[model samples]
Target: MANDPSVAHDPPPYGAEVFAFSHPAQTERLDSLGDLCDPATTADLARWDLPAGARCLEIGAGTGSLALWLADRCPDGEVTATDTDLRFLSRLRHPALRVLRHDVRTQGFPPGSFDLIVARSVLCHVPARTELPARMVSWLRPGGRLYIEDPSFFPAASSPDPVVRRLGDAVTTTLAASLGSDVAAWARSFPAPLGGLGLAELGMRVHCPTLTATNAAGRAWALSVADLLPAMTRAGALSEAGGTRALAHISRPGFVDIAHAMIAMWGVRPLTRHTEPRYAG
Candidate 1:
């Protein structure tokens, strides 16, 4: 069903040209992102009662950290890790894990193919963000859970620290301009639509971590900012001098601020056809 030629060919904002899988710093950036977010992700997943034989899907499984975790957690189960680029995922080895190069926008899975589905920091970059949840929900078996985590830069965007604010604004502005990224709105409003999607037992949480220069979040932010600097400067979202100053400020030991809030929303597909899903907002 995913290969249907009729599906719209909407490209992602984080395509190879903008954030290449071949970039030398990509591995490190992904690693830092995993270090920064995996704990919270795992904790949230642990809330569900996943069975040993569960069939799991991790969309946009960058670097395969969470996919490997699922493989370990569900040793007798099958885990499909998919990404548009597979270079990082190719390095992972696990008998229960299978890696595939897949695009969520243009491709899909058969209905009820998985028991659990998760995507972290992935959908926000997709132009078809609104349509993806239903597509993913269609892939889950009844009673299966869908968990999505995306970043809301509202905190950082309005930081009291001038450097942080400027950097955050520049990053969001450039991404919105060049890539059509939602930046904050989609993530902040994520929970509202799930109730209408035939899912039950909806829940939501937010993780706002403090970022210091040497911390994982800080490192990941710095890497991403560095990668986007050229485009940001070119778009006049950030000046050359401002970029330099912001980077310097972020690397200082005393520099501390709130990282973007990772908003996590989850819901379970109704076991019965007549079940009315309630919004947990």
Candidate 2:
């Protein structure tokens, strides 16, 4: 969810473009996302029984709000917050926090080093997304948990309002097509992968925020769509005329839509590990 306002014009690398990282907008969206997920995040951590001094990793740590919260919760613990673009995370300085510029696609975190790992809206842009769960699992200590929150756009774009629905669908389709990956793939296909990795205690929860023109989340969505309209039109996925109509609809009073769906996946690494005899007896 971290985007660089300066890089918005340049075409994003096929599978790595972020739609909402400008200055004021990025801040707004971060606030919106925090409000939307705070309860779930708190509940998930509580379920995991996050221990004091727990080692945590937060990938795609956007403005580092969640990471900061984690640091506060685990005062004696350490939190590593990473993102490819570190600008937005630069301002978060804390004794328990370490910020890194790491690409989740290529770099690997130290194996079995963390007690908890979390990501939000990150895997959608990863080209090598399928193998990602195993990689994250590898970094977790035995019995540690991995929490991932990813977006599924279909639910949100399927508005009761015909004009909003049509435009929303068109915009997301074009965006995904241009990005060279299906951003919503996990919505229908994540549990199998977790099972394949032999993770235990698997569970998923879906969060779909209700939106209205007056609400923060709704305003953020509209602003983001408006910002992306120019690019969508130029890319030819969205016709200028269509973009105009969509933008108008999004801006109108009393407009309502569902914020994109966020699916949270949680799993625990087994505590016992099988190893070969030390002496090969």
Candidate 3:
């Protein structure tokens, strides 16, 4: 019988170093992210091709919205939605969906167990973020797909809009320095590891949408920046008055900001390799 990996360990308590995971507004932020990136995510899904009866796994399945969609699309298969904090994903109720309180850094899916693996805006906060993609890609069955979407905040930080760019750049620079995670570097060198690992058909796309208060995606972007005010202030990225002004500017009529670039990248495991026998039992 196939083992239930979810039972192998007790779900670790949710106090990880990841910024969003620790943020009080994480659920709202993740939901907003889903709304903001829905179209692009859908496009990537179409490009990668989600087949019916294809087993899927979504790491950092924040709020499980995208995971739920995957479950619906792969109705004949199973979708495992995993995160360290299950507060949001636990709410999803579907026969095809399996919710697991698992941390990607510490725990892992069985090798070659999944047909598709997806994660969005997740790698930035991870301590071993760079090493994770290789591990994740290994969990796929031969010819299976791995899709990752991470952000490059430099573009938004350098936006032509002065008011918006000032705040955006300050927060991004401060956060990256403090966390020691350079997103711009990652964006510039994405998918190279996949290629090195011998994965085939690598492809990537970068999207930077204009954010205005009128649209759901834009409002979400603004709210996400607003939510980081406290951290930005503590990090000396923005003064109290500057933060207040920036917050107000985003809400004002005709306010606009360019969102960080979302870089979507994917690769398929080669079909010629024989499935590893270690995980078959």
Across 1-281, the per-residue lDDT of candidate 2 in tens digits comes to: 24766564423642244454544566666666676777777677776577678999999887787899888888899999998777778988889999998888779977989999998877766656778988999999997988887777777465677776666566566666565445456655655556667677778887777777677566666666765676677666677788777767767787777867777777888777533211100
| Clash pairs, model 1 backbone | 2-108
Which candidate ranks first by lDDT, i.e. highest? 1
> lDDT ranking from best to worst?
1, 3, 2
Q: How should the candidates be ordered by TM-score, best one leading?
A: 1, 3, 2
Error of 3 at 186 (Å): 1.5
RMSD of 2: 7.0
Off by over 4 Å in 1: 1-13, 279-281
In the order shown, what is each candidate's alpha-carbon RMSD? 4.5, 7.0, 8.3
Global lDDT of model 2: 0.73
Error of 2 at 236 (Å): 2.8
lDDT of 3 by residue, 130-233 (tens): 88988998899998988888877777666787877787677676556456545666765665645566677778887887777767656666566666676677
lDDT of 3 at 62: 81
Q: After superposition, how far is residue 250 of candidate 3 from its true place, in Å?
A: 2.0
The parts of candidate 2 lying over 4 Å away from their true place are 1-24, 273-281
Please, what's the RMSD in Å of model 3? 8.3
Poorly placed runs, candidate 3 (over 4 Å): 1-25, 50-52, 273-281
| Tens digits of lDDT, candidate 1, 98-210 | 99999897899999999999999888887678888988999999989999999889998878888888888888888877777877888899687576888987888899988
